[model samples]
Target chain A: MMKSRSRWVYMLLMLLIGAFHILPFYLLFTTSFKPIDDLSSKWVLPETWNPDNFKNAWEQANMGSAFINNLVITAISLVFVVILGALAGYPLARVQTRLNKWVYNLFVSAMVVPPLTILVPLYKLVADLGGMNTYWAVILLHVTFQLPLSIFLFTGFIQTIPRELEEAAMVDGASRLGLFFRIIFPLLKPITATVMILTGIGVWNDYQFSVFFLQSSESQTLTVALSTFFSQYVSNVGWVAAGSLLSALPPIVLFLFLQKYFIRGLASGAVKG
Target chain B: MEVGGVLNREKQTERLAGMVGRNKRLHPSAWLNLLYVPALVLFAVFILYPFFKGIQVSFTNWDGYSQTFSWIGLDNYRRMINDPNIGTVIENTLIYGVCSTVFQNIIGLAYALLLNQSVKGRGIVRTIVYLPVIVSPLIMGYIWYFFFQLQGGALNDVVQLFGNQPVNFLDDPKWNVWIITFVNTYQYVGIAMVIYMAGLQSISKEYYEAAELDGASGRQRFWHITLPLLMPAITVNIVLNLIGGLKLFDVIMALTKGGPGYASQSISTMMFKVYFASQDAGYAAALGNLMFVLISVFSLVALTYLRRREVA
Candidate 1:
């Protein structure tokens, strides 16, 4: 009897927690469907569900351009972050030298310094190179910010692999590069996948560097684009709601699809390193 | 004695050299060392050089654009001490950091305990909770900005269903800070929960079994067994959340722009406003340096204590 009562309380608690977790999105969705007239008016349900809000938001925000730009930057950043992180991780994991140790420390310290601190100097650098308004500026910053953490993650995972495999490869006359591509690279698939997902999500969601560096309207990513909606249509409740929802959709979808890997990667990336 | 010992060492050295020569023809340890050069160069260019440049720029009175500048030593640091916004922004950041850290841990640990129940759909529930973490905080802020809108927001709509007036969550100064903290707490609770869950799972069930055999209640077992063991995860989560809160920018930028009179601005947001918006790059860099020093000092003190406790 007591145990059953305890179980009931537990269920109630879980239900409450779940509701809180999902409530903001629920609110977002409902507000997105409301008409401008109904948006500020108190109503449990929209008198008429307005699909036009989405249409207006997409066109006014130029989401098509923003989406393509975001996709390109995120995809390219992920490829570079994963490849570079793995390569950096491999040597740091294998080699024992004062220089390697110093390099490792340098990477670790980079993680602690907040990216915003360097935003001004980086901005100046990009502006000097004439890359300020280009996609490469945001892409490069994302890569730079992500590289250290991803390298740390990859290094931790790499350390768990037996050194015997690489030593054996060396005995078999494989070049260091050949041994890495043949053995270490193939073996690093799991960690690489984790790096890709984590870094991909990070790059996909970045706002600061993107907002600062990519000043051109043509190059505006989804984050900057969604923000621009607010600045342009400051008082348009319907358009803001609709634009907000559209901005959130891709990530929500990505999370749902990669739920298993993302959850694992998040925990491993944080706790392991 | 010295001559005999030196001769013996020379013989050993010759033998070692011959062995090394034999392996050197095959093993490219020296060449493998070169693999790190490209990555190191990239790091120096992108990470190291930029950081030093930031430090150098901090000491100067350069606007981001002009070629001419004078070095203003300690003026930026002095201005930060007298800045009116400094106290309020720091206060807001601390409140946000502490509240979010405490609340996230308490709720997260609870979920971890509850999920450990042999319940169905546990995995699905965990995944659902983690969903928001994958989204950008800027986008999350945009969505919630609408949610907290005084009218036509779902929050207000729901409140009206209960016959209460709509609340101005973002515009009101007091509530605005809490609301900002709330959104941060809301988005990150899942991550904290998942991390705690991992920590919880690592604990052996035998302790619980032993406690049950001793006629302990579920609450007692948890306080004794679960809470103590989860400290490492707690320490890690707390540090991460606190630092994250201190450096928080995007959400603050998108949601309130540190408005309602900068009531909800954090250290990071203030830094941005000063540097980019106000064009006080030197003062902003001073602020950034302050945060860097604070974080380094706190981490050294707190993290060391945590590590020692873990070891004990």
Candidate 2:
């Protein structure tokens, strides 16, 4: 009887904490659907459900184009980071040479160094290279900053796979590149998934890089677009709430689909760091 | 057979080396070098060169626009020392860092302990708690902005339920920093909890059983067994929170914009203003360099201290 009583207390406590986390999301979604008249008075639910707020947000924020820009940048950056990260990580994991060890350490150290420290000069370099306001510029920067962690994760992962397959394949007259593609690359699916979720969300949700690098309205990513939208519509609560929800949907949906890998990825990354 | 296969491959590599007219025996594949070239070039051009270039820029009088500006040694650093806003920025940053780290660890550990128990609906609870972590901080900040609004905000509505006057949470300077810290802690405690849960799982069940057998209380067992064993998670959590809090930009940008007249400005936000708003790139670089040094020193000190505790 005492044990059951204590379990109820625990359940109540957990429920309270869960409610604290969910309350803002509740407010956001409900507020988005609220009409302007209901926004300042109603807290729990909208008096009249208004779906047009999303349309207003999408059109006014220029989020339609912003979403496409973000999708392109994030997709291109993720592909490059995964492929290049795997290529670089494979050598670091397999080779015992002094150069490889030094290179691996360099990448690891880069992970802790704040990327903002180099933002000024990087901006200058990008401008000099005529990369400002271009997708390739932000794509390259994302790939670069995201590379260190991706490489670290891939290297740690690849170290666990046995090398006998590669060696045997090499002895069977398979070329090294062919061996990697046929044998090693396919084996990297799990880590690739982890890297993709980790770095994909990072690039998609990045604000600092996008704000600094992409200056044009046409080039603005979803995050920048949303921030600009909020400032412009600061007085209109319903529209701003709708904008926030739309801005948050992609990553939240992705997280829901890949929830298991997301937790494991964060845990492993934290443990390793 | 494995050893013979390796030797045979070495011999074939040597034969290939001879055929290529190179004296060195190729053990590691040359294709590996080719694979690393792109990563190396990207790192060199984007990361390596820019870091050194930033250091050089910090000493200059360049306004970020002019192509030609003479180097002025230590001038920007000296100005940073004398700048009145520097003190507030540093103090706010330190408070944010220390408070966020403390709260995140304590709250996260509590949640981890609860979840570690055999609770029903553990999976659902964990998912809900960690959901905010996956959401972008920019949006999280805006979400909380609505919550903290005076007239129709959720927080104000809750306050009114108790017959209390609505507090202006964001606009008031006194409560602004704390509110920011709270929001930061809210978003990130899940990460700390997940990490602590991982740490807790690694502790053997026998330790607790042994402690119970020795008649040690739950509190004693926690301090003696659990806390000591959880040092690694503690280290990671503290360092991450400290660095994250110190370099906080997005949430502050979305929520406050370092507003109410720079009362809640952090070093990063201040640096952004100096560079873009003030057009003083050299000074901003100096500030960024100072932040770099501060982060490096703090991380190193915290790591060493926490690691020593783990050993002891």
Candidate 3:
């Protein structure tokens, strides 16, 4: 252990690091609350703590509709991700057939392919499908891209579950699929949470594909809506700030509540995969 | 962790599947593999198809939206090689990819080490560092945007207090890419820290205890014990950051939009400009392919090189 006198230095450094990390956020806090007329520097807190920025940004940015679109897309994408990712991971993890191995590799390799690399044709494909402004188009894209990591995580997690559970279930005359539903699905909750957290956040905060696919004002998600708002009101720093803050509120709130799961899920799902 | 599972996973799965009764009659379990059909179809339609189509489109003379275009046959690729703006774009991409990786890893490792100590307020500090990572990168960039914007910006205000001119951090070519990298590094270093912390915890305290008994200096113990043992974590972080930073689009779009006239254009952002604004979908597709290769090669090489060191 470090000496008591020097330990204070380390603790001080820790607090300094915390302050350093929180600087942008603190600035965001002040800027978002301030009115556009306030000529104060970003370092200063709002003079009167105007709530108009929030109201204006919310209305101008259509934050309500964007929030709903984000929710619908993220929630639906997550459902497909869990169902397809977990189901695919089961055979890939347990069966280990040559075909299964190839399929698993195929799924995992897609993780490295930056989705933007294919944006040129993907955009055209979506447009051709009449999916240009549709939620399903973006939802499917999110589900597809997110599946690789989800499958990878689910496969890795499933491998660790003991075989005895399945073996015992088999002795009681449970079919493989039946046993999967009965035994394996329940054990998947922990890893599923990790998958959901990791993939759900990725889908929720998505901009790359969404920016391309979800172009209409009616279909825009939070990030898209914020970008549209920022470009339209390029000088409305206050409104932009407010919209940015509002859009980011959901995941930030979620992370705060599930801090343990968030950290652990990232560590296990990403690094291990 | 399961990168090392390759050797044992076979025997384990075999034993498990053997007991589960490997059906000899047409392998009934093979039907189970059909569960992935929907996923495979989605991948083929969305990813696999577009990926190949992008490569095909790169060779054509198609504007982003049109029914008629000639097959230019490598003209777009050739143009990319000679394009005036591309040199800066690629350089910026590297700075985003390679430089951000360096900063994130070094800073993250330091934070991990500091937090690994029995320090007060470590947990809260860890949370603060990681909070930015969950926020959208666009919003994170915008947050920093308020701090660095020239007029009435926080940094400028501090400069004025000191009676100095506020530098244009985001607009200057010299500083634009670096600032973008910095913001990105700020957003993601938490992930690296958390990974490194996990690695550090997994390292046995007995190693440090024995090193202390041997009168090894703290520096020597760290270099000899900690760094080597943390190679796995290092590998994961490098590949992750490299891939992430190379494909960085949102932050650059949010911060400078790859501008003050292409000063900070990365391959990702530049591709967006070419495809949408310039309407040069063919050239954008070519750049897209270049990025694909660049990301694949960099991450693959890093993975291989780091994975080797981990075994050693």
Highest TM-score scorer: 3
Fraction of true A-B contacts recovered by candidate 2 = 0.61
Error of 1 at B89 (Å): 1.4
Against the correct fold, how does model 2 do in TM-score?
A: 0.94
After superposition, which runs of candidate 1 have C-alpha atoms over 4 Å from their true positions? Answer: A40-43, B1-30, B157-166, B214-220
- Per-residue lDDT of A1-273 in model 1, one digit per residue for the tens? 997888888777777767777776776666678777763442345677889999999999998999999899999988888888888887787765566778888887777777776766777778888887787777777887888888898888888998778667655555556678898889888778788887887888788888888768899988889888888886776787788788778877877887877778787777774
Ranking by DockQ: 3, 2, 1
Residue-by-residue lDDT tens digits, candidate 2, B1-312 = 795566567548734654342234444354466787899899999999999999999999889988898889999999998998888898888877889999999999999999888998888889988998888888899999998978788888889999999998888889999989999999999999999999999899999999999999989999999999999899999998988887888888987888777789988888888899988999988988888888888888998898788734
| Interface RMSD score of each model | 5.1, 3.4, 4.3
Give me the TM-scores of chain B across the candidates.
Answer: 0.85, 0.88, 0.91
What are the lDDT figures for the candidates, one per model?
Answer: 0.77, 0.86, 0.89
RMSD after CA superposition, every candidate: 5.6, 3.8, 5.0
Task: Provide backbone clash counts, one per model.
Answer: 1, 0, 0
Q: Which runs of model 2 end up more than 4 angstroms from their true locations?
A: A39-42, B1-27, B160-165
Candidate 2 chain A, run of 10 with poorest lDDT: A35-44
Better of 2 and 3 by DockQ: 3
